[model samples]
Target: MLIELKNVKKYYRTGKLNVKALDGVDLSVEGGEFLAIMGPSGSGKSTLLNIIGCLDKPTEGEYILNGKNVERLNDDELSEIRNNYIGFVFQTFHLLPEYDALFNVEIPLIYRGISARERKERAEAALEAVGLKERMKHKPLELSGGEQQRVAIARALVQEPLLILADEPTGALDSKTGNSIMELFCRLNEEKNLTIILVTHDEKMARYGKRVVHILDGRIESITLN
Candidate 1:
């Protein structure tokens, strides 16, 4: 398994009340699987994604990613895992407005202290993979919504991460643009055998995954195979 979450729970203490963001959630994902997590607002889907992505640790339970038990890892350890193994795509493109696509895509590698020559090459290849090679020199404001998202995807891919966690990746786009973005995801999953966990409320978007996991009230309510 690429990911395993056993009886995971995340709770936040808000004065006298404890909010259960995830309650005894159990989920396992095999390598190269495209899984969608569907949920309504305040349903804990984003919190679940956050845990899986190592952006936050569960309050209790086991989380094993690529064979390492990560729930109890130190802050630096978790940061290393995030930098070396995982990629994240958010609803907001989160691109640097001042930089061009190529530079934005090179940011991760720069943090890793990779050579400038190699970073440029890898960023170029990633942009090509996302069908945005021609826009490599364009700034975020110069691109359309779909194009900006493509740049974000390229930035994620530049690391060649084992897993990609996309939180409402298509939420900011029009239906047609969203469909195109999802199709791009499909192509990447098929062509690169990339493992993708997409969190979205849209059923149309969830259907693109090989398996759909529906979450409600901090628990998984159903799992369906496409």
Candidate 2:
């Protein structure tokens, strides 16, 4: 299994009042599987994605990524896991407007302290994979919505992460552009064997995945196989 969550619970203390962000959520994902999580706003969907992506820790639960327990890792180790093992794609393409596509995609590799030549090579390859090789020199402002999202995908890919956590990846685009983004995800899952976990409120977006997990009130309401 690529991911395993056993009785996960996340709580927030706000002036003596406890907010149950996630309530005993249990989930698992096998390698190479495309899983979609669907829920309304404030449904703990983002919380689940954050935990899975190593961006946040559950207040109580066992989260095993690959074979290692998440709680057992310290801050630095957790950072390494996020850098080396997990890639994130958000609704808004968080690219630096000043940097070109190639440079933006190279950011993660730069953080890893990789050699400049190798970073360029890998970044270029990732952009090529996303069909953005021709736009390598273009900045975020120069690209369209779909192109910007593709750049975000390439940035996520630059690390060759074991898992990709996408939160409303197509939310900012039009329906046609969103479909194209989803199709790109399908290609990555099928052709590259990338294990993807996507969070979306759109049922049409959820249907693109191999399996769909429905969330409500910080708990899983149901799961369906596509």
Candidate 3:
């Protein structure tokens, strides 16, 4: 299993009241699986994604990622897991506006202490895989919304992570563009055998996945094969 969450709960203390973001949620994802997480706003889908991505810790329960118990790892260990095993794509293309596509994609490799030559090679390959090789020198401001999202995808790909977490990846794009992005994700899953878990509220987007997991009230409401 690429991911496993058992009885996970996340609660926040807002002043005196407690906000339950995830209430005893359990989910399992396998390698090469493309899963969609769908729910209305405030449904805790994002929280589940965050915890799976190692961005947040659960208030209770165990999270096993790639056979390792995440709850047993320290902060630095978790950071290493995130850097070496997981990749992320956000709804907003968070590429640096000042940098070109190549450099933006190279940032993650830089953090890994990879040499400049290897970084450029891997980043360029990733960009080409996403059909952005021609725009590698363009700044974020010069690219279209879809192109920016492609760059973000390339950044995620540069890590060659076993698991990719996408949070509303196509939320800002038009229907056509969003479909293209979803198609790209499908292709990646089919070609590379990578595990992909994406969170979205759109029914159309959720349909692109091989399986759809519906979340509500911070729990897994249902799971269906698409």
Put down candidate 2 lDDT per residue, 134-194, tens digits, no spaces: 9999999999999999999999999999999999999999999999999999999999999
Q: Tell me the tens digit of each residue's lDDT in model 1 across 1-226.
A: 9999999999999999999989999999999999999999999999999999899999999999999999668999999999998999999999999999999999999999999999999999999999998999999999999999999999999999999999999999999999999999999999999999999999999999999999999999999999
Worst 10 residues of 3 by lDDT: 23-32
Candidate 1, residue 193: lDDT: 98
TM-scores for the candidates:
0.99, 0.98, 0.99
Tens-digit lDDT string for candidate 3 (1-226): 7788999999999999999999999888989999999999999989999999999999999999989999899999999999999899999999999999999999999999999999999999999999999999999999999999999999999999998899999999999999999999999999998889999999999999999999998988999999
- After superposition, candidate 3 runs with Cα above 4 Å error: none
- Candidate 3 TM-score, C-alpha based: 0.99
**RMSD list, candidates in order:** 0.7, 0.8, 0.7
Task: List the pairs of residues colliding in candidate 2.
Answer: none
Model 1 score (lDDT): 0.96
lDDT of each: 0.96, 0.96, 0.95
lDDT, candidate 3, at 55: 92
